[model samples]
Target: MKQAFLTALVCSTICSLGAPLKVKGLRTESATNPIGVSNSPRLSWQLDSEERGNFQRAYEILAATTQEKLDEEKADLWATKKQQGAAKLLVSWQGKPLKKGQKVHWKVRVWDKQDRPSGWSKIATFVVGEQAKLLKPGRISGFESSSEKLNQLYRQSIANLEKRLDAFTEGDVAALGDGSAVHRSARAFLYHFDSVPHLTEWLRLMDSEITKDNFFPIYPGAQTTAPVSSDSGVLVTHPLWWMSGDAQPTRSRWDAYEGHIIAREAQDTLLKGTKWGGIADSENVAAEFIDLCYLGFSCRLILELALPAVQPQKAIRFQVYASRIRKSFERQFVNKDGSLKSKSQTGHVLALRSAVLNPEQKAKVLADLIALVTKNGSKVGPIGAHFLPGVLSLTGNQDLALKSLTSLNAEEQKNYTESGIAEWLMTFVAGIDTIAPGFNQVIISPRIPSNDSLSWVRAYHDSPTGQISVYWKKLSPDSALKAEVMIPTGALSRVILPIRKNQKITESGNEIADAKGVEIIERKDGKVSLITQSGKYSFLIK
Candidate 1:
């Protein structure tokens, strides 16, 4: 009897310890703007955790939509673990790119290494907006912002974006789904083009179906095929949207153009000096122009990242990008109200992208572009519909950007809510604070700044590799304040400490990364410091 009792006790203890990790302390301190909101509607959660690590974890983040069968991999919509820390988890809910308005219930779940789940978190519902926020004398932030924390947050945040991109490249519906022309995704840019004939045919069809360059690209409302017996059509719960790769019947024709010269020959022969004019020669079509511009943008970045260039002739392609955008800018776009229909008109007056033009001309061209978008934006607006200007602008008030949106009627909001766009602007202002001294303020700690009873708590474990870090770039006009760094010890395998300056983070341990996962404390004395396992490196904040 004694031996049986001891065995039973041991079994019970092990089962309790090995139970699937539970998620508690569920509170949303802040809902930063959903990512790629204008193009891809999403929800972001900033929650403070009282629970520690469950060590090796797997998360199930999904959007509960009208559809019963929710396949994230098929849908192309995905969730990512973002803003990870010792005591907080910022899980962003990203819905797939969808047609006008689709409501969704998004939530997340975490699983331990043992494959048992702690259950899903609360679902936050939101609608996808066709247009992101346009400047309306309001500040814009988020892209390549200067805030150190925001930048660091990008490390975690972009992981999600990278995965999102890969979904499209890997031939998924979510990635292949596109709702417009002017707002083509990175996925659209890489649409299957193995042959020139196929590419040409596809572009022609795309021009009519969804190119913003042609006109308002979205389908007229009520034209979509709703699910049977349901008034509410299919909802976009995943990021990868409805993709059926059969759109291009002859996509294989472009394979012959692989020799570099074929692409060039097509550019010069079919397009140059004739009605089908080449990109550099000023007669380039808007679709072609955007395509080359994106290609060139990609090339520049790949070269910068030290990735080998597949086609060495990309340098020449760069020369063609300007002609595309410039010609489109100069062309008389079909206007809803006689507005210049080009990205330059939407903004982009100061792209330090190329050193080809003289400073005066470059500035003048950029200004002209901004002026076009700012002046006549009201006629054909919701700038994000066009993609360029709505995102690129960041400053004091988005008054101009807002104007570009052409106010949406209540009916329109049903399909095009600015919920995420509004938050993106908040992040936008924070970004400005990091660039210009008086641009805006960036809030570091208290990301979800709240006095609510909604917070949750969880358990944690210890590992040398598991760590956390919190960063802040002087957001206030004054110097750094006494910020408290909170880390959930349960999730950490190991802890390290270090400080970052001018975007450079330095670590301590030689054998191990000192406080690599540790947090930061930037004090008023112009010194920055952090606690590592062994010691702390302190520097006064300026």
Candidate 2:
């Protein structure tokens, strides 16, 4: 009874205001939060009470050209809350059957519990997006035409990487002499980013020198090991194994540091001979690390492009990466009792992390990752090796990935004093941010190789835009085919469509046709066909 009386007293006190009610907020302010011409609309306002009521009470709203007499009474609305989401007073109404580029006006009205109207509000007007001015002929303030085009390009770049494999049998490429590892390094490093011509040119140069007998040592079961500084340049080498030695230089801005990783890995394995698992010094270790790094880079790019949402490769590349990591683990780190022989638990974790994408594989991968954290000082330097697994952990529905990012060391966790993990640590650390940012490292203090020259195999194309991008020049000049096409009147026509000369789209894959982008069509006689250009398939890359 006492509480109720207090509430009544408070309510009574709230009704004794003397100022006249004032309507201050106008929702259609284009000055801020530019109004959008889409399904969702933003509204805002400020309403002050002119007089007090027995209770801090009710309100109504109306919209029309004239604030004067209203013949057709519209629905009355009310608001009890003192404040809400953004503005002091904000309410929104969906524009029904909204016309394109149409401009409309509106206003709000209010009333108290005693049933007295507080007068109508000032007029506010809004204009929808002009159709002819936009890409489409309709109201569309929500979409940015420029941003949409960029999004399309990003999508197209990824599509090209997937449907096609950028790899060429070593036998096809020629040897780049001078042993400086500059051109050779570029030729061998491969990843999703290699879609750029610079990377493909390098891959083709390296690929030419790779004969079938020298490239693959044993196909699937092949070892990741490379002979450190061997006798023959391109003789009968490992047939099944993918050679990753002689790491390359950092190519791009973001790639400078991250690219070091690829360079370190590929340099280590493909240098010359196998010594300490082929990872020798800073430069050499960079090569070994790149071999592992490229796999993650490619997987991330492919997933980001084609299936923006469906990640973790749906269990394809992860398995392949795991097998190689396992081979390395057994070679150097494993103990007789199935326990770690060294304190670098991260190394072991990195070796086994690829399997985490699989629910069944997570248990094993998690055990290794956690063991590294538990047994070690929670340092993430070694964690980098299993970067792909860590990404999978964060993305593969694993609670741990999103759970405060505990795995990030001093360098990784900015809030922490010692968050960063060294790039050349005995055990590599995982990349947390989508794109791994690093230093201008010259492969110094290297723990493992991290770069690759010929690491990716892909195909690409763009439609309506008449463009194509690839990692290697695998297309042959002898291969050229006709592509029916359709060209947008003002747009540039005829794209350099790579095709096997007189080659039909038979079984194996597109001989010369683009693997990704849409074929610009030809609407001749009301029939649609693709417009194309003869691609220069052969290269004298030396």
Which candidate leads the pack in lDDT?
1
The candidate that wins on TM-score is 1
lDDT of 2: 0.30
List the global CA lDDT of all models.
0.31, 0.30
The TM-score values for the models, in the order shown, are 0.31, 0.24
lDDT of 1 by residue, 465-530 (tens): 121223323324333222222332232212121123433334332212343334554433322333
Worst 10 residues of 2 by lDDT: 439-448
